[model samples]
Target: MTKVKVENLTKIFGKKQQQQVALQMVKEKKSKTDIVKETGATVGVYDVNFDVKEGEIFVIMGLSGSGKSTLIRLINRIIEPTSGDIYIDGQDIAKLDKEELREVRRHKMSMVFQNFGLFPHRTILENTEYGLEIRGVEKEERQQRAEKALENSGLLTFKDQYPDQLSGGMQQRVGLARALANDPEILLMDEAFSALDPLIRREMQDELIELQDKVKKTIIFITHDLNEALRIGDRIALMKDGQIMQIGTGEEILTNPANDYVREFVEDVDRSKVLTAQNIMVPAITTNLDIDGPNVALQRMRSEEVSMLVAVNKKRELLGTITADAAAEARKNKQTLHDVLDKNIITVEKDMLISDIFPLIYDSPTPLAVVDNEDNDRLLGVVIRGSVIEALAETTDENEVMDNE
Candidate 1:
């Protein structure tokens, strides 16, 4: 389901051209020389259109003065549009009256800003519960919900602490918790982590990703940072002055940018690291052998000329993996090769980014299998630590080239 949709939206600020001209003439300043010579108000947004899918992390990205913030605020009805329509869950919010707009806002949307808008006098718990309390939720229930929200935000220990008592990240977490506590259908975040330091920003980014994995709320995040948009958005809408330049999935935009502006914005991103097994896996030969056999496995390993083998049981469920060293050691010990084989496997799904394989490469006991998680134990390919490091190096080189270009 589409959670929010905007169509032909436009916002114009300041006095109209004709009015300004008439006022200038009356003040004996000047007469309008021509309509083309007349300057009207600024257009904050122009003919903007897009739809946000339910449970998607949709991002609106642009440079400063590009109307991203205005668009978000307009969607929440904080600012009225000059002309256009906004639909939330199929209802045109642009048509809603004062009370109706308030009702929709109360029930359908929550927003987080870069500034943590916590009440200075209120404790963290109270701040989190403020929205629910305003909506007239019973005190006990709202308190419990606030506590759960704090726990989810990893601020349970600071429940009684005031906003000033916490770090910037913690305060932002509280703001997020406050938004989530309302359980609104949509969450709008406007550069919510932009004010934090680099390390804290990355921490918040990780926390937001983890939280999204669990909560999966429909979010429309506004930001000017390209890297941040790529990290968090399921799809990105690139905006210029009062207009959307392009809209596409991250990979689509990265690989096939709509114009030179978007290309330059993403040109320096490490393409290969962003690639997953889905992008690089190749077909390979395999053989089935008994786990109790030794001589047969050695002959098979040598004949295949492969360094390792993916292990599976009779049902083809992934059991473990075997390496050349284990096979040789087993042969020397006069034991079944399976006896020396590693039963632990560090692996990734075919759909995951190759970047996701880094921790496993650093931490795995053996080479990791790239499996098609949708299918049971189906081997996509295998990735050793060396291959991933090489990929990283290549990506670095590619980035350097892009920079130099």
Candidate 2:
């Protein structure tokens, strides 16, 4: 389900005739600077469209003056769109009157800001309860909810501490806890972590990712940092001037840019930091140890044109690997594959970064097994050296060997 949908949304800042002229220019697909110079009007956002799915972290990223901030504000009607539709749960938010819109703002969504917008005079628990209080939740119930939210954020012990006493990161946690206390369906974050020190910002990002796994809220996060966007966003929209340049998964946008502007925009990004094992892993060729004899394993190897085959049981668990030499030896000696299987295989999680994988793949003699640790160590795929290098060099080939390229 789509939690939010923005269609042809536009926001222009200027007088009446000038705005009309600018909207026409926008429809004519005029450049933002040209429109501003011609009509004496500024186009803050122009015909932007995207959807945020349920339980997604959808990021809008760009440089300083891109319409990312304006676009986010337009979603909740903080900034009225000149012409377009904003849909949340199939209702057109742009057409709602003040009371209807106010109700939606109170119950359906919450926004977290960059400056850690906590009340200086209130204690952390009181800050967390602020939204619920405004909604007229009874004191006892609101207190319980607020405490629970704080506990979820690992800040319950600091409930009595005032905002000034907490560190910047802790204060930001209170801000997040406060938004979550409302139990809203959508979260709108605009550069929420940009103020913190680098290390603390990273910690906050990790915490947010972990928190989203538990709460499953639909989040639209805005930021100027590409690395931050790639790390957290399920999908990203890259913007420039007043329009979106491209919208895709980080890997998609990095490896296959939509246009020249997008290609130039992402040229400087470190691909190793964004590419993961899943981006480069190819399907594993395997042999079943419980059923397959040595000849079966050798036949599979020969068919796949590989020196080895990963060995597993029916459950697809990562058992071991069987080399061509071992399989041939087993066939000549009349032995089973289980008797000659090598269990010392290197394994990595599917999400492990290519930067971290380089050394592991560089030193290992064989390919790395991409396994799901939480899922009974199930074999997901195999990550070969060529695939990793190709991925970092801005290519996405899911085949295992360099010779395949």
- Please provide TM-scores, in order, for all candidate models, with all chains considered together: 0.77, 0.90
Please write out the lDDT profile of model 2 over residues 1-405, one tens digit for every residue. Answer: 998999999999999899999989988988888998999999999889999899999999999889899999999999999999999999999999999999999999999999987889999999999999999999999999999999989999999999999999989999999999999999999999999999999999999999999999999999999889999999999999889999999989988999998887776677788878988899999998989999999888889899999998989999999999999999999999988999999999988999899999997888999999999999999999998877665533222233365
lDDT of 1: 0.81
**Local lDDT at 405 for model 1:** 81
Clashes of each: 0, 0
**Model 1, residue pairs in steric clash:** none
| Candidate 2, superposed: residue stretches over 4 Å from native | 288-291, 300-305, 312-318, 372-380, 389-405
Best by lDDT: 2
Q: Tens-digit lDDT track for model 1 on 1-405?
A: 898999998776656664454444423533223321465546577779999999999999999988899999999889998778999999999999999999998889999999999999999999999999999999999999999988888898999889999999999999999999998889999999999999999899889989888888999999998888888888999998667889987778877899998888787877664567655555433434454465656676789887777776555556676677777787788877557767677767875777877876787766677787777866767777777787778788877887788
- Global lDDT scores for all candidate models: 0.81, 0.92
Task: List all candidate RMSDs to the true structure.
Answer: 6.8, 4.6
